[model samples]
Target: MKLIIGGAFQGKKEYAKQQFSLQEDQMRDGKEADFEELFRVPCLYHFHEWIQKGLKLGWDFDGITERLLQENPELILISNELGYGVVPMEAFDRTYRETTGRICTKIAAESQMVIRVVCGMGMVIKNA
Candidate 1:
């Protein structure tokens, strides 16, 4: 599995398409997908939104993580880096940011490759 992260609109999707030779149809928009449907796609974009949905639905992080890992599919995940700027004032926003960071860390640890996209360029952060 591969993980790609960056700020919003930083071309993470484009980078994944180029790097993985994936078509737009092959990439699932996490915002529109449920947990069960996520594994069906080769790439998952807007992962932050998926996390938000899971949180709203009261899903446990460990459950989601385990389910994802158990699938063991070659997937490219795209998430916006929400922890780089000023801390959020709202309680929910703060939780979302922290949760996203933790989840990304867990996924990255299991991923074979991790890349950060900035201004349409992909910088490899990890390869195993």
Candidate 2:
């Protein structure tokens, strides 16, 4: 599995496409995809949003991780870095940020490669 992360609109998706030679159909937009679709797609964008949805639906992180690992062990995940900005004023936003960070940490630990993309450039943070 490969994990790609950066700020919003930071070219994470483009970097994944170029690096992986992925076709348009191989990548799923998390904002629009259902959980089932997310599992089926090789690459998933907006991964943080999917986490938020899972939280809203009362799905625990362990369940989400287990399902994802079972379905797509070779997945490429793209998520924005949500913890760097000013702390959110709303409780939900704060929770979302924290949850995303924690989940990303777990994913990174398990991933074969982790890349941080900024301004269209990708820096490999981990390789296993």
- Residue range 1-128, candidate 1, lDDT tens digits: 78999999999999888888999889889898887776667899999999999889987677555667778458788999999879989999999999999999989988889999999999999999
Q: Which regions in candidate 1 have their CA more than 4 angstroms from the true location? A: none
Q: Model 1: number of clashes? A: 0
TM-score of 1: 0.94
lDDT of 1 at 111: 86
lDDT of 2 at 107: 87
TM-score of 2: 0.93
Identify the candidate with maximal lDDT.
2
Per-residue CA lDDT of model 2 for 1-128, tens digit only, reads 88999999999999999999998899888877776776788999999998888778876566566677888889999999999969999899899999999989988988899999999999999999
Give per-model CA RMSD: 1.2, 1.3
Candidate 2: stretches off by over 4 Å:
none
TM-scores, all models, native as reference: 0.94, 0.93
Which model scores highest in TM-score?
1
Q: Residue pairs in steric clash, candidate 2?
A: none
